[model samples]
Target: MVFQIAISFSQSIYFPPSNSSVWDTLSISRLGWCPDKVNDFYNYLDEQQTKSFILLKDGKIVLEKYFGSFTKDSLWIWYSAGKSLHSVLIGIAQEKGDLNINLKTSDYLGKGWTSLPPEKEDLITVRHQLTMTSGLNELAFFCVEPGCLIYKADAGTRWAYHNGPYDLLKDVLESASQQNINVFTTLQLKIKIGMSSGIWIQVPPNHYFLSTARDMARFGLLMQNKMVWNGNPVLRDTAYYNAMISSSQELNPSYGYLWWLNGKQSHIKPSGPSSVPGPISPHAPEDIFTAGGAMGQFVSVSRNTGLIMIRQGLSASDDLSGLDLHDLIWERIMDLGCITSNSASQKKESIHLYPNPSQRYISVDIPNTSPIEAKIYDLQGRLIQKSFDPKIDLKGFSKGIYIIAVTDKSNNLIKIQKIILQ
Candidate 1:
């Protein structure tokens, strides 16, 4: 069964009129952002070869700027960022009863779709492809042919960012829906949301999507609103939507259905060995998720701040999928809204985690507070346990990693730490 995450939030986001070509915009100052910081943000983005940048608040454009000869109408490739779009199409197919993500992919693609034997190939599922857990080998060049789809492990036992399996998702959608991808997207997504200027370009065995910056922002808004277009329910499959945004597996907590999630205790980079010991985007909001391409193409959303940040252009960051540049942009964006107080900044937390890779229990050197409480969360951001005592017990709990959050009487977050159990 799909875990149903409970989140309570109400935001009346502004939606552009369905028949109009114009968009409603918000001013930076009106949103409490200092006007002077705009230039500094621009300078950083410009030096990194940024072509276009757009920031939206509550579905309204707040900051939109184009660099060099690029304009609002310029078309830019989303590269691997288009993976998220394919995820959306897959969701649509599931909703229409055309396909089921839990079913074996060979059920739709037929046997011998992969280099593996028929029985081994049938073990792969649509959900595995969505979560990047097909366990396919990532060493070879990008080729979706059956000969190139070599098996590295059984599906879902491991998570690896292999493009070979992902690129075939388009073929799966075509076979299941019996309709061209462009026509399906136009009818199911574009017309409902009034989005224009997006098209898919196929290069040999790979597919790349291109669209204007505004169109990217529109796509962000659609997902930000839980896949609802204005008053219409575009993909009313809330279970799939939740699975798409929440952590898909324990191996990489920072990934969700082809999207890069921001807030998790630990993460594994694409094809990286072992697990990195902290949140992927440490400086950004814990709830933010992103869709990105090579260089710096991105579409990021943070429901906590009611923000949708987008960027496009070339860059030198070797960290493929544009994660490096996007994190830098978020750090600067966090500084835009307000000023900092030196007095409060000087006070650092006294808490510390001992025997970090502990096996049983742990303690902290925390300050006193009225009704102080400690909470534990899984990588999916779900609350697992809580305590009122100083010493927290971990007996009987599965061996892995978890996030500990301590709060005061007024519900103020005092400290957060990532702890491991071995």
Candidate 2:
């Protein structure tokens, strides 16, 4: 089936053909990105184990690259990122009057949904589940059975990323809507937003969704437009949409219903107890929010830039939340200087750094006649060392990944390369 989508900029809308192969493209040169630098960015993504990457500007395809054997039609799992899909469906159910966030989860799932007593169990509401504040003990966090849901604190008092409570939301949605999760999602979201290739798969503890890279981008565009698609309202309730992307609770200010929000003062991870300082992705724009998943799956929406970025593949790190990979992508994008007017000319000169994964020292080769400076920074953007010498010592450096940044006389970043110290 052919699905239509609308890309809006200011008051203008562009509708591309329904054919999947015919996406509108934006000029990389006009965007001030050097083609070679963009290739370097893709090379970095490939080295970091990305399978598919797509970037949309104003709902038009700006960059789309598939690595190795992965193609445009490849169906990949979204993992926990699918939670955002569920969150939206919940909003639709509320808009249809089939479910109410204010009502207790027990009202729909019955009183025995949790092991807590009548009074405590009744306190756990659908809203609490959506906010990751169900206050249920996370002993066997992956188990959604009643016996596994022991009480810890009262609902809305604490925030913990527990999957059991979140998984139960599907049950709540199913029971209240009197429709299967698949049916509800199809009728409410996929069909409306031109996510024609998406499908949900039942996995233990969570129901994961799989789709082509373009379909995921379609969902990102839907979010970028605030739940509207092709000038049609997919989600009519603006208040709920705002809440789903804003702070849903106090404990994790960087988290919404199931989305990972940027620009907050502090943020917490899935298994972390304390909130960390700074935005989830310091290199990304503050207004960006994302639906992230295990093994590097991401659907990022940035309203300020009118861009939607989607990535899916094996993770470069073991972190299930893909925080490192997410930050790395944004860091590379910033290094590309895509939005800068002189970015193309600035990237014209390429610097070669050698002996990567070095044991002791590395060398830099600059083609420019002018003197250049090199600075080494850790993954957290902390400067480790700065030097004018071609050969820099790494004998005392700890064993980890570090970025080598090269700047010219004007202090413009000409090249950035990642190296591992052994």
Candidate 3:
């Protein structure tokens, strides 16, 4: 009986539209984009290091594409972009009355909070950690050398991108939740915002954020929505969101929480373990913020345009240096207002596709007692094929990721899970 119910549920699953008309209707060029600008950016990305890109404006997807083996559902690692997730979750926790940033790290870890000289250890607060000003000695956090790991200064007296300070936040969150960071993130944030398939650490091999580029865009939208989803505020505080978006310290105009700032020189080292790369151009505004990852994974949020652009892939370098891509994205964003009118209506139906990681012969099941429209894309938003009825076969397809979105008579939207053919 349980198997029957499970099969029925699978048979009735619905897929939504891949692109929202609201975003398609906007005049993106007037907002500052030159004609064929996206193509130019895409070309550069191909030349540089990018696998997937998704652009959302005002809660609608403007542009989306995949390169190489990526797709709408491919779960690329977020690298340090995960740091921004840490900040936002902390904000949510504080608003939920679970923890306080004003408290010392000592409050959670107690004596474990110090490897430092006593005076310095006592002064560090959770707030200081959030701002990267905990002054916990760069060498201690880096330095492959052993004796090099000693506290050298007072807390909050300097700025350093030490991973230790950030890692400590995981402990703080866990202490408050009595659960691991993965569980906390899943229950409190991901599922609440309609993200069901996200792994916080260890993607395939190593611990990393494993999520679709679309889901990353959704995360960005949730932030853009101010933690509100489906008319409800999922995050506890607006002030926290504001702070996350702004410069958290006077020492860095380009750093906030664990996210990266786009606009000015923040005295970043750019080469050492603590180094943060400066911008490539001066025309870039200081108002932009991004969730940066090790590869080329980026979720850049622009305050000027209410835009969120996410790019996921391997950027083939070591030191943090990828300003040109951000610049190109902004140029495309300048074309975001009063342009075209998309004639597509809201999709209000449901369709289902199954055996997602199929070796061959995938199936589609629709509930309507009536018919539904379905389209399949091969990770790059390119139409690979279309299916009209309940069952579509994929016998000749290669192994990769694909997205199946469905629409009904009224044009409602539902995006289904990733189909992996391995």
Candidate 4:
């Protein structure tokens, strides 16, 4: 199927100039987000050991924050998220007629890549590797040696998150493209997408891609735009791109060519024995997909909202896979009202705050008949003031953006508005 760019956002998307770090930033208040809520979100991230976090709206930086000594230039490993990188490279290789995923793994690696007898090895194709359905013995874990690749079932019969087979794609790409993985990635994806800081470094059983948070956001934006970078086709194989992000097999509906998809009815998580009961992230938009890795690294793209969020740092929990932290970030995002789907009723019900750029005071105009209470917060999600009156005096308040969360007596969020104090 032809992949179409159906942007639902009202704002025009922005792309940073190639080979430059220059990108425009949008005011957080303009997005109708509570600064205090945003602050709270960051505090949660910091507590979770987040080194860097970024949120992009319409391809422009809405929020970019770093914790402690971490800076924009600090390099971080993507771990298994780099699996998605390999998937894209394989798509490009196929588009160039250099390799076909349908071909058997032995076609490129020769017959002895696996200990499984020749016939059994031949059954494993590049597609199986991409979909994590190689059916290799789970006992092998991270082992790729032939002795460790004993056959447990027919290729494509099962789905298991084995890193060994997936990592072999780098070798396949190297052989097919007649170039190093890093060089091929740079020429094909990094340079084109302005991922100036991205680099793939081989480390034993796997290859890790290291990049800055902005560069990771650039890649997420590329995927958000359906592999198109600044109107230039980065990977024009629409069919492959579509398949890469959609359900690739029946075993794992929430996985697509090494990428994790949200909103699917059921999903089999990494190392889990069976499929789970619900979507990967219940709080995120239904159309969202993600590239997640160890240590809380993530690049989540929401098609419904035209938003891309990236997080990288130490693990937030004992789970090394970081899926739990990924869901937690979505919860915080939901609280911040970042991805709330806008509707006509919602717009009408939205409270209006006037004299927004006021120096000393601001007034709230509620359209609903229900009595409302207001609480004010600063950019850090800190509650600074509370008032039941429609007009609040900001006489001594700091000169900056403030978030006013309006709610009913039951504490249900009625509306949120951002006002600027000069």
**Best candidate according to TM-score:** 4
- In angstroms, the error of model 4 at 339 is 16
Per-candidate local distance difference test: 0.79, 0.80, 0.62, 0.81
Candidate 1 lDDT score relative to the true structure: 0.79
TM-score on alpha carbons, each prediction: 0.79, 0.79, 0.66, 0.80
TM-score of 3: 0.66
Worst 10 residues of 2 by lDDT: 1-10
Q: After superposition, how far is residue 233 of candidate 3 from its true place, in Å?
A: 0.6
The backbone clash count of each candidate, in order, is 0, 0, 28, 3
Q: If the candidates were sorted by their lDDT against the true structure, best first, what order would they fall in?
A: 4, 2, 1, 3
Better of 3 and 4 by lDDT: 4
Tell me the TM-score of model 2: 0.79
lDDT of 3 by residue, 1-422 (tens): 11111111111111122333222323444243334656776776677667788876565555687988876667777777777888988998888788899888778766545566666677888888788787767655533222442575666666767766766677788887688888888888877767756787633222456788877877887766667775767786777888887778766656777777764544453343344445432333335577876655777765444556788777656644354455655544432222121332112223456767788766666544656556665432346777776566666786555656565555433333457665
Q: In angstroms, how far off is 382's CA in candidate 3?
A: 35
lDDT of 1 by residue, 1-422 (tens): 01111111224798877656688998765654646778888988999999999988788887899999999989999988899888998999999999999999888888888889776788899999899888778776478888888888898888877787888888889899998888888888888887778888899889889998988888999989999988789899999998888999998988899999987778888757478877777656678889978897898988765778999899997666888778789778755642233321222156565678898887766544446678886544467888887778988887766767666565555555668877
Candidate 2 regions with alpha-carbon error over 4 angstroms: 1-20, 338-422
State the local distance difference test value for candidate 4: 0.81
